[model samples]
Target: MEQQRSFGSHTTGTLYLVPTPIGNLGDMTIRAIEILKTVDLIAAEDTRHTQMLLNHFEIKTKTISFHEHNTQMRIPELLAKLANGETIAQVSDAGMPSISDPGKELVRAAIDAGVPVVPLPGANAATTALIASGLPPQPFLFYGFLPRKAGEKNRELEKLAHESATLLFYESPHRVGKTLAAMQTAFGDRQAALARELTKKFETFIRGSLSALQTYAAGDLKGEFVIMVEGAADKPAVDVTVPLKMQVEAIVATGAKPNAAIKLVAKQNGLAKQVVYDAYHELEK
Candidate 1:
């Protein structure tokens, strides 16, 4: 357990996590601008991108690159600078730092080293879309980008199929159609909403069944999407009367490969893949 007073005076310099506007520059907060101007150094996901933001606000603070690839080289240097009482502000290309972005590691290292870390509340695409989505907002699970591989993505969706809370996901325009289709297959045609080009002039929201969203996504794929899916109703009990091996075989008869069938049956029956695989192959022994 660790205690931290964000504003308390400390021997080391504080790390301020500042959020930038996602689309509209006007969304940038006054305090965030002030922090960016005052910090001794700004750790940015992309210095070029951040330079534009700094130029917009006329902020002259120097920035250093701190992204996924260079975290190993940057974290130590940033920590050492903090230890020398040189304040630093970490910002992503847009929105809050560390939300499906870089900065988490630096924040963790700073906390472990007894450096004060302060966060400023600001725009977030997830909450921005959730409140506007015609779905229940109290209980929500913000699952950022899903796994890219089909098998891994499918397994992940299977795990969330029975969650009662509203599910949020981020997807690139090119893959939104495929993702919506997968969600429909895993969770059925539940009501859902898609927000894109948020805060920009073309900002739009499409609300309907998952199938409808999939159809819409097939057309002009544009900005990044925030997908809000309604939570599942109480899950129906799986039938245990049929032997697991037989269940896998039935799916295989539908033209699915043997391994694919095993995975599907396991997910549908809430069993592990290895367990289902063993049961399906036990008859061959």
Candidate 2:
């Protein structure tokens, strides 16, 4: 395991992971501004987008685009600069770098190359939304964004459905409604919140059951969304004396669909969903 003292003496230049305001410019921290001003260069996810933030702060530090498309080519160059003792600060268009954004690749490269990787605390949409979500906060799983494809997304949601910690996700406005609907199906109508246009004049949050938020998402959806869902309730021990299929059938008798019952039984017994699914369908065969 490699240890690093952020400000400790190091031969190579440091890589600063700076965070920008998610929406409100006021959210930008003083230290973040100072780092951006002092760093030898700024590796931005989008040079044009970052230019606006720099213009606001009157920062003249030069910036280079280091987004997804060019990360493979840029990591070596950035590493070379760092090796030469040229400090660089990486920033996304908004919020912290590498949170559903581009920056992790360079961060890994920097660490592997023994360059000091220092992260500055600042704005982040997930935690910012969580505080006001009215859901349990400490134990949270921040799954930035789900897979875009339907099957992959559903399978991912199924895996997370049993988590006892609050779940966080970032979603585009256009797909937020569908995502909420999908969550409702996989995780039931659990408590959830949708925050959008965060820290901006039109900032808004819709809090309710997943079903309710899904309904609202069908309307005028605006801004990037931070979706927070309360985790699954703790499950009681399953009776080891009874068969797993019978236990699943008991849940189905309570008005739950067969698949939902199977999933729930699997979670409660700490078994794989597919295992419970096969057991439950044995009678059908």
Candidate 3:
């Protein structure tokens, strides 16, 4: 276990995790601006994107690229600079660094090297959208983004189907419809909210059932989306366990193809597809 006194004197320079505005420039904090101006160097996810922010605030601090592709190569260099007592500030293109971003590895390296990691809280799209989501806020899970692949995404949704906490997810407009449909299949006709262009002038939220949101997303896709799903309702404890083959049969009876039923059964039971396949074929025989 390591304890960090952010302002304490240390042999190495501190690594500051600074959060930037997601969309609206006014959301940028004064403290964040001061840190950017005073840090020895700014490690940015995209130098060009960060340049605009710097230009707006008139911050002359130099920035170096430290995105996903170059993280491995840049961590050591950034650590060496910190070791030499040069304060480093890390920022993503938007929002907080390392939240589904590229700063996590560097932060880990700095911690291991005994360097202080100071976090300056500011804007975050998930929380901003969550507060206005009309869902229970205390017990909410922030699931950044879903898998791009249909099968993998389906498996992931299956795992999260029984979660009691409200669920949050980031989704691109182009794929929101498909994702909503998948959620409908996995979680049933649950209430959900779709927030897009958060913190911006035209920010909008579409609140409805998963099926309705899926229909809405079928229109002209626009900006980034934050999907907030209502949690599963509490049910009295009961031993409602059914056989795997029986479950597959039930799904097949609902007009799903045999292979599709097998896949759904495997995902819901957290079993390998081959295992479900064998069991299903045996039952068929």
Best by TM-score: 2
Instruction: For each candidate in the order shown, give its overall lDDT on alpha carbons.
Output: 0.90, 0.91, 0.89
The RMSD (Cα, Å) of candidate 3 is 3.9
Candidate 1 lDDT (Cα, 0 to 1): 0.90
TM-score of every model versus the real structure? 0.85, 0.90, 0.86
Top-down lDDT ranking: 2, 1, 3
- By the TM-score metric, which is better: model 1 or model 2? 2
| Candidate with the greatest lDDT versus the true structure | 2
Candidate 2, 1-285: lDDT as tens digits: 888888867899999999999889998999999999999999999999999999999999999999999999999999999999999999999998998899999999999999999999999999999999999998999999999999899889988978999999999999999998888878877899999999999999899998789789889777899999999888777788889899988866644457877878876888998888888888453
lDDT of 3 by residue, 17-126 (tens): 99999999999999999999999999999999999999999999999999999989999999999999999999999999998888999988999999999999999999
State the lDDT of candidate 1 residue by residue for 175-230, as single tens digits.
89999888876776789999999999999999999988888988988898999999
User: What CA RMSD would you report for each candidate?
Assistant: 4.1, 2.7, 3.9
The full ranking of all candidates by TM-score, starting with the best, is 2, 3, 1
Candidates 1 and 3 compared: the better one by TM-score is 3
State the weakest 10-residue window (summed lDDT) of model 3.
Answer: 231-240
